[model samples]
Target chain A: MPSPTSKPRGILPAALFAVVTAVVVVLGIWQPFEPGGGDLEIAGGGDPVRGEALFAESCAGCHGEGGVGGGGGPSLVDSPIDEETATRTVLAGRGTMPAGILGGTDAVDVGSYVVQISGAVEGAVPPVAEEPPLGPAGEVQLTGPRLWGIFVSLAQPAGATWTIWLDGGAQDALRVGEIPAGQTTFADPDLGIGTIIDQYNRVIIGEQLQDFALATDELSEARITALKALIIGEGNPPGANSLVSVAGEQFAVFSDHTRFLVEARDEANLANIRFHSEHLVNIALGAPIADVDQNGEPTNPGDGVGLLGQDGREGYLPQIDAAAGVGTIAPLAELVPAVEATVADARVCGDIASVEAAGPCVNAIEARSAKLDQLWGQVPDAARASAVLALERP
Target chain B: MSVNVFVADVSSGYADLMETVFTSAIVGKAWLATAAIVLALVQLLSAGRIYGKLGSARILSSRAAATVHRWSGRLAFLFTLPIVFHCVTILGFQTTDTRVAVHSVIGSVFYGAFAAKVLFVRDHRYPGWVLPVAGGTLAALLAVAWLSSSYWYFTEVRFGF
Candidate 1:
């Protein structure tokens, strides 16, 4: 046997293994150090003073000054609504209140202001029921004013029916009969727009909750569960309720169809292409196309909400004249064939294998390009120049 | 493909939790960096002791030193898993700024260097310089990653959570 002074055989490896295993096990069981309580700090800290100003401008009309009860809106001061609920309520609107017009930072600021001034009790808003808010998987019931807002904004003729062209050339005609004066389930739950609207609503809810959690320096389990539910859209049909389905669809189409079509002519003219195509689509949708003033600012704002409006104006407009003063260009329907022909020629050029075949492809591309140029050229120089100038302006 | 999807889902699932658990985004990263640096020092010192280059065989037996080095290295690697997961799944590989670009490149290389070091340690048939080179590269990459992220966070951004 070896002397006692000599290290035991295999002890080093055994000891090392034990130590590593123990560390792993301890780490697995040990709770990560959470910066809860006083240790937590909100990222990009909020200013309640600035938030107060924003709230007065955007919210006081309905909520009254100092968030006291007034004018069809409930009392916001000492309101039981938590920060999360208040933010979501402001963003999506509830009951008679319209959806908040404020963007991200402004929304957060207003929310912070409301929380500060109102002394809103935390965790006051009741938990959402376990059941999915939008109904079952394939059949999601789209109810509430937010969905109505989206429907009204995107409706084909601002009344009657909405038409959506799907990815495989299937056209869906949804009869939106009347804008619901109150919360009502949509008759057609299977429409893709309903699904998109639902997803958007959930995202808004989740984001507000996240903001609340950050502001409070506490990510409660309830908040996490709610956020996860909203994000995952657990009960929705596979791929329908996810952000990947809604926003992803928009992005993919914009990239593959719109970008591809525009880039075919001249890759360097993306800014001009974006301006023209977006406005063209806006015009097609029967929304107002704004006229630029001498300073290149949109003079006559189109009456449409969100990014769909060409004029970069916010709020609702009853009727938008597509061709007020602009000279006669071909109708949007007439322009589609030209755009398609150009795209087809570009594709053909991409597929050509022979050097000799390149001549005809070039000629075909040039002809289609000229056709589009002539078609777009019919519109008055003022309108086109205004759009170009607006695009270039900060 | 399924595996990739699964990994992505799991990574995404923990992203919010990770963000919440950390002190502040910047400070939490600094803590992780400090831990990694300390472990790296332990690894280097133990490695030196194992090679008998520290001039004190009495301090720790070669086998004991090797064991310490191995475990310290493993611990360091374990510390990086969550950071890597967050970076890959949530942040993706973005080069929007100079700082982010350098961090992204270093983070990408750190994993490869780690793999090389682990392999070299196990396989003795390689040239003697291989293990040292691999270890040194991993250390260097980790240092750069720490500097670009945590260092920048502390110096430029506030130190508090």
Candidate 2:
């Protein structure tokens, strides 16, 4: 029997809370959500070594070992394929090729390895076939007290040789002994100091290098002074270089995805565009290196979860969250909920803490959700949205 | 064999079997805990209705709510078996940290509280408020136990199996 004045219990709020808690638990257990495939899915640098094994497992049957064309697939060697073409072809699976034999970072890793071997196999030019980046022309060895294994993981497996260029000499393809990948030199390469700086920064933040020697024996004094600034910043946790890594990736990765979003829009592939939007939202909110809820580093995802070591690793979202999700990360906050809403509702909108901001998000989600198929026209707007996120990235 | 060794054997044996269904024992524990929480909520809601703390203007009459509460309570208890067995036998009692200490303390009392609540339900001679207090205490203890271990794992470590 019910009281005459009894009202229905507000079960909706309780149900909604239960649902959110379950999602959070899922996200916690499934840290490092997979990036749905796109041309730019695996942006920037990747470990070719890890990719090589993945390639062997996933692709060698069709593409042959070391990508030296087999009876089943064309020789990747001497192939003019750039990273973008390779990525798109591999993910979309052209001709008799199957789609998604590999995906996510593994796909990107294989792509990186494929591009490297494709050029290296037949004395070919760099993957991009561009003129060498010019800078200080000097040859120096990279050696230190630390085991080269750390750098090896960065590039070149043990006993497998890498070819860097002493393009400092008056020769093209001026090959140096096994150096790391980022110390890049295309045939007739014009090497840039930026390459060395990038590599050194990675070594500093990602891997602990005690007595890691930076061979500057042959360097000009001016170069050494610049190197000194970078060297001095090492050994400190969350160094300026670490911030640069996070901040830089936020812009670079987000910008790359924004371009992909535009392309997906042209194709009007709803899933693909939504995929990039998800990454954009990730850059704006979800993915973070640190556990935001706890003061201490989280114990899950034990792969250096809060180490802030990996230069290109995911952590900016956590950083923003740590900073209290405010005056920072301004990527089309207004328009984002419209797209994020398409990601199964106001879950993402809840991440936007500003009550005032959330008002439009809830409305936009409801209004524009039914029109997702026609969301292609909004690609240009997504690009603007990405740019908005870029301003607030790290 | 010693009790510690026997406990370890049982825990490992159960966990090894669980691996066939889950990626790891912890993962199995996670899903089980989630199921228990959902069922516990059902128990809470239905109990509220039966006690007149809530009214069933909807399809739920007092008798139906009582039935729902009983079944949900049984299922919820069943779901906690594997988790509690593994935790007690494998990990045992520990006060290594604040979270662990708090969880261990609450978990130690949960079964006792649950037993008391069950007895109180059957005994018409008991005071009116005792059963509800014991039942609420059991649920709160379970919630806190979940927050300490499984929740931490999902949030701080990994979310999916």
Candidate 3:
């Protein structure tokens, strides 16, 4: 080429080199897409040693010697109740149980012991099954206190009512009133904040016996409660040899909804991503009791008994945060307004207007949502299927 | 239209696509880098043959070596594009650790060297050994980049996708 002249255009190459270097520097500073799928060593909190005696005296009466059930209560051994929910339930009570029988720390310990014995926490205990406590389609089955939560959910709607025949042992009193929906009431006066539903209506939290159908589309809360009194007059879930709406019959809606939402993450517009995330967190914990999180001005009755609340398990949210590798993502309690602040930085900054510019925010959101998916794995399939029924009614 | 939306779509979509073939994007990158390294090996051998450093009888003919060198270099460059896409656009230059810092530092200048080499290919005003030296430097940079990333990925992380 022209006898290969000794003179070279140094300025052009230098300019090109400078431009490329600048591009890399800009890319480095402007964005950071973190990698997922690493070792998430989730060391659960709470000790089991403290929970032994508490489980023996307080829980053994109904749950049997080792929480095996076949007694007054369903089996807690090998069943699904997250530690947080169990701790709260032990502290507050559910169904026939009275509240404040144990210390807050011991409550966690009791739940942990139950969870360990039940093989709910997976790696914490030996592997019972290869897969997690999920159905084929990844669902959690609700039972026991969670079942009572469903029973309570039937009466939680604004107009729904239950004529509770408060069995004060010697069959003393009957509370036939408005009683309000989703209030943590001292139901039996001395029983503290405990859910007491003794017989009457179509609302059954457990399908143990099945045939629990009691259509409550228009039944007043009192009427519904009275009907429940008749069906389960003796108290405890009615025993049926077979079932119609078995382990997630109409519950396919939740699985489908969750799948759509998770898959939608790929093509998410980001505007509603945070909204859905906050919705999920609220569903896990309630503000003014069993109200659906972020649904109405005062929180609608959606899925009551958060997965992290009483009857679920403890340390669930913290475990999720640990797995995320992001450290303390959002508010743990169901504080509605503060949730929006969590995503304010990503959305408020007008300068971040492109994919590259939105890198840090995208990274954060992805890390969080992915970890939330892991939380679902802890829930049993039956609980997952049963929990969504709150959304099926008024 | 919004930055968050655009990023969410691109990053998740890309990750989901990579996950379809491999376990994750990181695994996909490891395999992709290995492929690039193989192509780079072809470039090295072919370049040696073209430079008469390698015996014609022991390797391909000079013309044949030149053809192989051109094609292998092009292919190697092509193989690195996706990796560069994920590293620069998605992960960027991370310096979380010694290995990562080295990878980031070497990776940042990789394209810069490519730009200089491209310019030198056209302009013959440089010394005779210039192109060879540039090519060697690129290979060394790529080798280190592979060591810090793909090698680390296979060794420190899981070996399988």
Candidate 4:
């Protein structure tokens, strides 16, 4: 019944197929192909229940039960305020009202609930904003308090080793005397131009209006110029600026700020260092620090005070704090110093000029890079990896 | 109403989990797609050997090669299901731009071509050129799908892990 030419069935190909199939299936299920870690869930619709609970705890005393205007707060019930306006009101606190202490998602959730109870369930859920195009780098606003924290954190035991490079000044401007954290007497603070109270009520220096400031004392003039360009602009005739220009310019500042912290051998500015470091981590992972207005542009532009719009600040503070509390910021904070040290050592190597002299610096950079890789390998989650990777390049 | 709820629940469940998995890992979707393409190449080669297109070398007997071709084709097809499910149920058939439009069109045709190949494979009564045409069309569609997506991802977004 069988032709003589028909070859007998071999078990090898079938066996190999089974083994390969098994491996592929296992790999799919285990998802071991992920280089860093699992994927991160971008923020989406808010949980109204959580929002309601947050409102009861923080809003009920002022706005009354179910947001029915009472006790000095206007009623949100059937309130004509749209979701955007409500979000702003809750975050910034209208008139005598204080800013809400809720995170961005929580704030949005609360806004949703208020809209729902007001019988405007239609359009209660706001449309998610599309990711802005990765435009050329432009000037980013870095906060004075955070920069001061980075400076103080990285300071040697004697004090922070660097001086602030101000515009229209012949030399780097050094702080004349110790200005305590809450003091407001100094004419100019270290980072920015004016003085203002941070969300913490602690008096802090204003935004750094200068083109750039030295992130670390050891940085060469070229590196300083590069870092400054990243912060403000390259002074490249208007539209030619880099991605640091219009969107997420804070990231560039944060990247260099963390790099400066690498040489920090003291605990003096550790708290400040951690605070700004956490902010950088949150922003990199698509956290909204500022609310773009209806025209899809940054509201309160050139406000010259807070990094975020007045309303955005209310929401930004708590979300960053929450991100810090959960240890999301810890690995990144630790990794920043390592990256900073490696880049600094590389710079030292580059300064040697002569190839013979440069060998040791090159070797040191290579070794430090290997160590950095090992540290990167130890990162436990994808969210951390995403944030870290952004800093890894620049 | 219940059906709509079920569909929403299922779509959200898959979309949220897969989106996280897609964006979190660096160029992961691209890499998985690359792996699928490599398997597809193997399917193409084995299919050719079965058809005697590789001259008279006869690396595999007709029976053995045919069996390998069938199984490899099945596996290659199976490899695309998750990606297809994600695209269809979550992303839907979007044509937002040129690249996406090309990808969506090829992706839709790929399933149709694949169905034809499977049907042809089961039936030996088809014309001589029919099976080859079906197989060729499926492979070509997959290549376009890969070119529009994974290739673009690697070159433009990121190449290394």
Candidate 5:
């Protein structure tokens, strides 16, 4: 070997090279970004008040009293879809469930509702279950009239009860027993409409059951009398249930030709459900009577009760006519003019906020209109003639 | 007669002999095939005389390299002849019926052009043009083969992208 050389390889350069090599190795190993995966924001918390309402209306029926599934649905209180995963599950669809469970604007509404009551997230747990109702469960006599008032508050009807007071009229002393806790008591003409009071006194509208309500006009009286007959237990032997069938087009199809269709949102298909679930709540308590909507078809004929006429007979199915039933939607018609005028005003004014307000207002009015139309439609002609006969005799 | 003499004279049996000679040449001279292309490029630089402007004698020595390059390119065509026969017999390009008729014709044209390039090398003052044309034709043929096979003749159908 030549004389031992004394030249520096420079510690700094070597260290720099080592650092760069380390960086490259780390970069290769830890590929931080992956292609093809999509991005989604997780659900934050939601309003408990809104959550409670949604639970009562949508989730409570299937998932038992507190997100515990009863007969038909799986309990969700400690389910797989925790907050982060719940958002993902809803967006992507789980096992057999399809997407958009509650589509349109209600999608957000319903999704927030599910996350709130699911108890998988913090800050939205259920209230401690209360002790069974204080009074004896046996002597708890919940009459039709008593049930109706409790249902109204529990239902959270769109406007205030006073609004109903202005429209439906008031009545006097009525006895209601066997009420559930957190329920309202019943009085004659619980709502304050004039005809409602008259009908209560006259007994044309009997001790109102949860299913029955006082219609605002004579036409409605005729319709309800006829419809009450076809219901399963109506005037039939004790314990008889009604059987009805309605059909509609299929919604989705897969490669195996298995198609998916639904009778309602936030409600399970009737075939795979139990009576004490949220789905039952929707069917028995939440569903409105099926009626011809602006599309001139029953808003939900596939799942809704068939309409009857004023004469104690089933109503004739009429073709949708824009003009004929335009303002004559017996129970729901009053809101139509305001809605129509709103649409016309939006056309004239052309301001976006005004238009936005107009659209929802129109939609709300339309839904009401559809309900009244359906109720009036059920009134049989014979009932109309009978009422006329009853009036003429006096 | 010697095999080379018979091939040079184009005798009746020479075509069969040519096939044998060319096949063996391809196996042994595959490396030469790569070298031949390099030599051709060197010859081009010399003929262009840019090296001569630099006053290097290396440019003057490119004549043999030019002759060999021309001969090797022509030999490549002979090597390709067996490929066609192999494709037809083993790959089944030719028979009573086949769909790749277009492929077969394009392949024949490619090989034929390669042979012509070698034969015509001595005639033109600037013979490099043939090399480029042959290269372009070979590339196009490869592209066609790859695309048709990769896309399955464009038969894969679906709803959207």
Candidate 6:
């Protein structure tokens, strides 16, 4: 009964099918396309939970439960580096970096998992906002033996608790206090010098004073001196100080004290390192005090003045972030001769204070350095890769 | 109630409501619920306009409409009873929030009015008194739900939700 012009029922069905097909084709052309980055099946699918356990075992000694570094390592949480970059850095050792901590399928899986969990990759060191002068900062009143322990754990809750107040001078003043987790507190009084903590455990101000310290006005000079001393002592010292001797260059014994000097390198680096170390110290033994340990109390040693007796504490020891990485501190006794030689060389040739000129001394020590390579050789590929990432150029 | 208890109740009640809405089964019985809600709305609206005219010409003259409205309302209310019970026992009792109590009160009232409508219609007498009761109860129930739901939606949904 179909009309001649309409054709038979079969034709009607075909026409309808043709129309639907045309619509689908048009839609396919008009819709936005997403090109596949490819299903890159890595050897092992990095299990976040396993990675977490591994992090606690091997990495936690430096990187915390949250991927933030303590002691020798730098923070890995919220790192800005992409997964690919992080993977590559972890695989290949860089300056002062150990090779192959995370290699093989396990390394790939762990690195991939870390990249997945760390939201935003960051530079070598987290940048600090301009802080105002807070008078004498880094002053901790450690009376009880347990006070040091409490201070060590202060920043563990996460986020930034310490803030900087500018005194309109070369040395920036930082106010150490407690802030709630996951909130940001500004330094401005009107804005409430203290606010809340953020996703990074960086509270504006509140809770216990996570250990803080002051930077010398001559920050660069201090860093250069410290680096020179460390390099000569640990990098290429002579005789009994030698941890390892390659060719003719000799390395020195590493100690907590030596690492402290290198930790206090730059203003920003110093703050982060100090904050990290304090958290570690708090976690380990409670607080950093003189009588509490060999360092002597803040009150003792002429009311805690001068370098040895300074009232403020030193190092963010507990925060072992692999990114910032830890430098093996060569003992001063073994390194004195090399340091003296470098000093003599610098005095004879370039300015001792010039950080730029100090490079040669650091390099000479590095050239003779053997402990790092030895350590790198002992660890698995994944660990070596992570160590490499730690030493990568900022 | 104490200030703490009051706040807890309000928060718990809101959470309970959300859980019910999200997890409810809308399949199979959708028609029954939809029909009841529609009839209840119409009856409530018509009653409001009439100023308490239940057995008046407007309703009595529309037998088909009245039957549909009456039957649908009763069936929906009957269906809602089990859902209410499940929600109360599962989500309501589990939380300390007082809002659960408020929800229970409103839901009970809704069922009460609905039951009265079913009874009135069953007896074949319009039961002039039952119409106002149903209408008033529906209005109160709607007010509570609308206010609470609207406030919660505005606060959470307007920005993030």
Question: Where is model 6 chain A poorest over a 10-residue stretch in terms of lDDT?
Answer: A385-394
lDDT by residue (A111-227, candidate 4, tens digit) is: 656666565666554222143211111111223312222222211111112122222233434332332323322223344332111111111111121122212122334433433
Write down the TM-score for model 6: 0.23
Better of 2 and 6 by lDDT: 2
Model 6 lDDT at residue A77: 64
Superior by TM-score: candidate 3 or candidate 4 = 3
Residue B68 of model 1, lDDT score: 90
- Residue-wise C-alpha lDDT for candidate 5, range B45-142, written one tens digit per residue: 44444224334555344566445544544554454443333332212222222324454444434444444333333334333465455444544553
True-structure Cα RMSD, model 1: 25.9
TM-score of each: 0.30, 0.32, 0.36, 0.32, 0.18, 0.23
Best by TM-score: 3
Listed models, DockQ each: 0.03, 0.01, 0.12, 0.05, 0.01, 0.01
CA lDDT, candidate 4, residue A105: 43
Task: Give me the displacement of residue A160 in model 2, in angstroms.
Answer: 27
- Pairwise TM-score winner, candidates 1 and 3: 3
Residues A117-210, candidate 1, lDDT per residue (tens digit)? Answer: 6665354332222432221011122222112222211111111111121121123323233322222222432444543332232211010111
TM-score of 4: 0.32
Cα distance off (Å), candidate 2, residue A148: 37
- TM-score values for chain B across all models: 0.83, 0.90, 0.93, 0.82, 0.35, 0.49
Fnat of candidates, each listed: 0.00, 0.00, 0.29, 0.00, 0.00, 0.00
Query: Which candidate would rank higher by DockQ, 3 or 6?
Result: 3
Fraction of true contacts reproduced, model 3?
0.29
Off by over 4 Å in 3: A1-6, A32-394, B1-3
Judged by DockQ cut-offs, the docking class of candidate 3 is: incorrect
Better of 3 and 4 by lDDT: 3
Per-residue C-alpha lDDT of model 3 across residues A1-394, encoded as one tens digit per residue: 5357467766877788778977886786554332111111124746675576667655653465566553235667667766666655654345434333343344556766777777767676622323222101111112243133322233222211212222233354433222243331212222222233333222222111111111112223553333233222233444121121111211122233334334434564443333343444334443434222233333312244333333444223333333222232333323212223323332322123343444454455444443434433332232223222221211
Model 2, residue A139: distance off in Å is 26
